[model samples]
Target: MLYKLNLEHILFLDIETVPQRPSFADLDENSQMLWEQKSQYQRKNEITAEDFYERAGIWAEFGKVVCISVGYFTLKDNERNFRVTSFSGEETRLLKQFKQLLQEHFNLAKHLLCAHNGKEFDFPYIARRMVINGMNLPYKLDLFGKKPWDVPHLDTMELWKFGDYKHYTSLKLLAHVLGIPSPKEDMDGSMVKDVYYNENNLDRIVSYCELDVITTAQVFLKLRNEELLGRDEIKKV
Candidate 1:
C-alpha cells in the first residue's frame, strides 16, 4: 500500500554557503564601498564590522554553496525510516551528485520536493548553480511558471500562513509553537558562513543542513497529522 501522500518520493534538502574572498588586498572597489556603508551603519548601532560582515555574508555566500544535505524518508509497515546524506565536495561535484540521485531514485514528475522556503531560496539556488555547472535541472523544478498550488512543491512556511498572509513566521518559531524539537539550537543560519570559512569544517555545515531537513520533516509530519490546526480546516497537501 502507498504510505502517506508521496511518502516514498519526498526529499528534504538544505544547503550551506560561504563568501568568496579576493585575497583581501585585491577586493573590488564596489565591494569596498558597500562594506564601508555597512560599517557606518554598524557603528551607529554599536556593532562591529565583523558582526555585520557575518550577517551580510549569508547572501554573498549563498552564491558559493559549500555543502548540500538531502534527507530521504519513507514509511514502512506504519513506521517512518529516514536516511540523511551529505554532499560536501566541490560545488560542481555536489550538484552533479544531487542530479544523479534524483535521476536514479526519484521520478521528478511524481515526487514531492518539500522544503522550508524552497520556492524562494533553495530551489532557485540549486537551479542557478546547476546551470552554472552546465547541468540539466530535474523536471520537477520546471514549475516556475505554474501556480503555487498547481505544482508538487510545498513550502512549510507558506502553509503556516494558512491564508492569512500577514507576518512571516520562522521555522524555529513554528517548531516552538508546534512543540517539535528545535534541531539547530546550537547554530543558526547566520553562523553557517563562519563555520565553513573560519573552521574549514564541512561536518559542521553538514550537521546544520541535516538538522534543517529534520526540522522541516517534523513540521511536515505535524501538518499531515492535523495537529497544527482547527478541526474544520482542510490541510493543504
Candidate 2:
C-alpha cells in the first residue's frame, strides 16, 4: 500500500505587490500633501515597494500584485519533490491562471492549500483579486466564517505562534530555526518592486514568490512534526 501524500492536491502560494498609482485629478489637497510627505520619505530612505509591503501595511489599497508563484509538493519514495509555477503579468491574467490551475489539479475535498501569512494576507489578497477580475473563486478558497483549525488551510506563521501571540515570527526566521536554507536572504521582499520597475524583470519577482512558497512548505513540515506528531522524526511518505 502506498502512503504518499497527494502532492497534486496541495498548493503553496505567495504574491508580490506594488502601490496603486494615484491620479493627479483624484488627489485632494490633503491627499496631495500626504503624498508629498510619503514621496520625500521614500526618496530619503530609498524605500521600494517590497519594503513598503513588509513594513508599511500598504497592501490594503496601494498594493497590486505583480507576481504570484505556486509550488506543489508530493512525497515519492520517502522524499519530497516540488513542481513550481509562476505568473507575472496583469492581476487579472495571473489570477485567472491560478484559478485554472486549481480546477485542473486539485479537488476541494481532498487537497490542502498552504501559505506563510495566508490567513491574514495572501488568501484575502488572492480572493479580492479574483473578484476584481470577475472570476469565480474555487471551492477550497471559500473559507469565510470557517474556524482556522477546521479548514484545509495551513498557515505556517500562525502555527509558529505556538499558542502565544505576543511575538510574531517571519518566514526567514522560521526557516533558519528549522535548519532550512534561506533562499531569499540575498533579496528581501522590499527589493521586488524596484526590480519590477527598473529592470522590468518578471523572473525576479516570480523567483522571490516561489522562494516564499518553498520556505512556507519547509516550515509546515517542521510544525507538523513538532506540534502534531509530538516527535521530531518525520516519515517522508
Candidate 3:
C-alpha cells in the first residue's frame, strides 16, 4: 500500500506545543483546580500539580500549539525534492494559517494529513485547538461520522505497528534504526517549554519542528523502499 501511495498527496506534519501558560501560577483559580484534577491520572501521589505542569503540552486542553511544520515531496529534475514550510507564532494565528493551507491546497479527496503518532496527538490537538480558537474544523481533520476506513489521515507510527497494538515506537528511534540521520542536535520535546517561555526563542522551536517534518517525510519514504531526499533537495519556505 505504501509503495502505491502518491508522495505528493501526503502533507507530512509535526507540531510543537507548550503549556497554555508559562507556569502553573499563571492559571486562574478555577483553571488551577481543573488542572489539578486533570493531572491526577498522569502524576504520581508525591508529585505536585505544579511540578507536573511542564508536561501540559502533551494534553490539548492544558496547552497551546506554538509551531506546526509541514512538508511534501515533489519532482525536481527527475528527483524527489522536499519543500518544508511552517506556520508559527500566536496559537490562533498559526492555526489559522494552517487551516488556510488545508482549505486551499490539501482539500482534495486524495490528499491526506500524515504524521508520527498524529491520530493520537497531533491531529486531535489541532482539531481541538481549532475549535477552541473559534475556527471550523477543516475537511481533512474533521473525522465526524467518518467510517473506520474512510479517515483521510495517515500515522507513520501506526503504519509501523502493522496491527500490533502492543508495540510503540518513537520517530527518532525509528529513523535511527532505519539509518536516517538524526535531527536532534539542539533540543527535544522535554525542553520546548523552557525554550519557549524562558528563553523566548520561537525561531529555535520552529527549526526543531521543521526538522521533525523532514524526518517524518523521510521515514515515510523509507517505508515504501524509496530513495530519501538529498540535502540539496530540501527547500525551506
Candidate 4:
C-alpha cells in the first residue's frame, strides 16, 4: 500500500520549537504556577519546575515554533529532485506562512503531510500553535470531525510501529537503523533550546530542522522499498 501511493502527493516536514520564555523566572507568576502543575509527574519530586523548564518546548502551551522546514519530491524527465524550504522568524508570522503553504498547495484530498511522528507531535503542535496565534486551522491541520482513514496525514513512526502502540522510535534512531544518513550530526533536539535562546543561532537551528525534513523523506522512501535520495537531488529553496 505504501509503495502504491504517489510520492509527489506528500509534503514531508519537521519543526523546531523553544520555550516561550528564556527561563522559568521570565514567565509570569501565573505561568510559572501553570508550568509547575503541567510538569509535576514528568519531573516527579526530584527536579524543580525551573530545572525542567528547558523541556517546555515539548508542550505547545509552553513553547513557540522557531522553525518549520518542509521538503517534497518533484519528478522531471524520470529523475526525482527533492525541494526543501523553511519558514522562520516571529512565531505568528511563520505559522501564517506555513498555513498559507498548506492551503495553497497541499489542500487536495489526495495530498498528505508526512512527518516522523507528526500525528502525535508535529501536526498537533502546529495546530495548537496556530490557535494560540489567533489563526484558523488550515484544512490539512483541522482534525475536528474527520474519521481516522479520512485524515490526510502520515506518521512514519506510526507506520514503523505496525500495530505495536507501546513502541516509540526517535527520528535519529530510525534513520540510523534504516541506513539513512543521520540528521543529528551537529546537534540534537535537546540542544535546540540552548542554541535558540543562548547562542541565538536560528540559522543553525533552521539547517538542523531542514536536515530532519530531508531525512524524513529519505526514511519514507526506504519504508516503501524505494531508492534513497542523493545529496545532489536535494535542493534547499
Candidate 5:
C-alpha cells in the first residue's frame, strides 16, 4: 500500500499542545471543579485533581494546540526534497491559519493528512479543538459520515501495527528501529507543557514539532521502501 502512495500528496504533520492555563488554580471555579470531575477516573486514587492537572493537555477540552508543524515532499529531477512549515502562537489564530492552508493546498481527493497515532490523537484532537474554537471543520479533517475508504487521514503508527492491536509504538522508537534520525536530541513531548508555560519557549516547541513532522515523513518513506531524506535535504519553510 505504501509503495503505491504518492508521497507528494500526503501532508505530514505533528502538533504540540499544552494545558490552557499554567496551573490548576488559574482555572475558573467552575472549570476547576469540572476538571476535577473529568480527571476522577483517569487520576490515581492517591492523586488529587490538582496534582493531575499537568496531564490535562492530553485532553482536548482542557488543552489548546500551541503548534502545528507540517511537511510535504516535492520531487525535482528525480530527487525528493522536504519543506516544513509551522503554524504557532495564539491557538485560534494558528488553527485558523492552518485551516486556510489545508483548504487552499490540500483539500483534494488525492491529498492525505498523515501523522503518528493521528487516528487516535492528532486527527480527532485537532477536529475537536477546531469545533471548540467555533471554526468550520476542514474538508479532510472532518469525517462525520465518510466511509472508511473515503477518509484521507493516515497513521504511520497504525501502519506499523500490522494488525497487532495490543502493541503500541512511539514515533521515536519507530524512527530508531527504522534507522531514521531521532528527533528528540532535545526536549520531548513530556516537557512540552513546561516549555510552553514555564519557559515561554514556543519557538523551541515549534522546532520540536517540526522535527517530529520530518521524522514521521521519513518513517513513511522507510515503510514504503523508498529512499530516506538526508539531513541536507530538509529545508524549513
Candidate 6:
C-alpha cells in the first residue's frame, strides 16, 4: 500500500507545544484546582502538580501549540523535491495559518496528513487547540463521525507497528534504525518548554520542528523502499 501511495498527497507534519502558562502558578485559581485533579493520576503521588507542570504540553487542554512544520512533495524535471514550511508565533495566529493551508490545499479525500505518532498526539492536539481558539475544525482535522478507514490521516509509528499493537517507536529511534538523519541534535521535546519560556527562541523550536517533518518524510520513504531525499532536494519555504 505504501509503495503505491502518491507522495504528493501526504502532508508530513510535526508540532511543538508548551504549557499554556510559564508555570503552574500562572494558571488561574480554578484552573489550578482543575490541573491538580486532572494530573493526580499521572503524578501518582510521586511528583507534585507544580513539578509535573512541565509535561502539561502533552495534554492539549493545558498546553498551546507553538509551532507546526509541514512538508509535501513536488515533482519537477522528473525529480522529487520536498518543500517544508512552518507556522509559528502566537497560538491562535499560527493555528489559523495551518488551518488555512489545509482548507486551501489539502482538503481532498486523496490528501492525507502524516506524522510520527500523530494519531495520538499532533492531530488531536491541533484539533483541540483550534476549538479552544474559537476556530472551526478544518476538514482534515475533524474526525467526529468518520469511519476508521475513512480518516485521512497516517501515522508513521502506526505503520511501523505492522500489527504488533504493543510496540512503540520514537521518531528519533526509527530514523536511527532506518539509517535516516536524526532531527534531535540541538534540542528535543523535553526542552521545548524551556526554550520557549526561558530562552524565548521560537526560531530554534521551529527549526527543530521542521527537521522532524523532514525526518518523518524520510522515514516514510524508507518504509516504502524509495530513495531518501538528498540534501539539495529539501527546500524550506
- Each prediction's number of clashing residue pairs: 0, 4, 0, 0, 0, 0
What are the per-residue Cα lDDT tens digits for candidate 1 across 110-141? 78788887777777777777876777788766
User: What lDDT tens digits, residue by residue, belong to model 2 across residues 65-165?
Assistant: 77878877655776556666788788778877778877888756778788888878888887776776677888777777877665777677876786787
Error of 1 at 106 (Å): 2.2
In model 4, the runs with Cα more than 4 Å from the true position are: none
Shift of residue 169 alpha carbon in model 6, Å: 0.6
Superposed model 6: Cα runs more than 4 Å off: none
TM-score, each model?
A: 0.77, 0.74, 0.98, 0.98, 0.97, 0.98
TM-score of 6: 0.98
How many clashes in candidate 4?
Answer: 0
Q: Which of the two, 1 or 6, has more TM-score? A: 6
Instruction: Go through the candidates in order and give the C-alpha RMSD of each one to the true structure.
Output: 6.6, 6.8, 0.9, 0.9, 1.0, 1.0
lDDT of 5 at 120: 94
Error of 1 at 61 (Å): 8.6
Candidate 2 residue 184 Cα shift, in angstroms, is 6.2
Name the candidate that leads on lDDT. Answer: 6
Candidate achieving higher TM-score, 1 or 4: 4
- Judge candidate 6 against the unseen true structure and give its global Cα lDDT, from 0 to 1: 0.94
Q: State which candidate, 1 or 2, has the greater TM-score.
A: 1
Clashes of 2: 4
Q: Tell me the lDDT of candidate 3.
A: 0.93
lDDT at position 134, candidate 3? 94
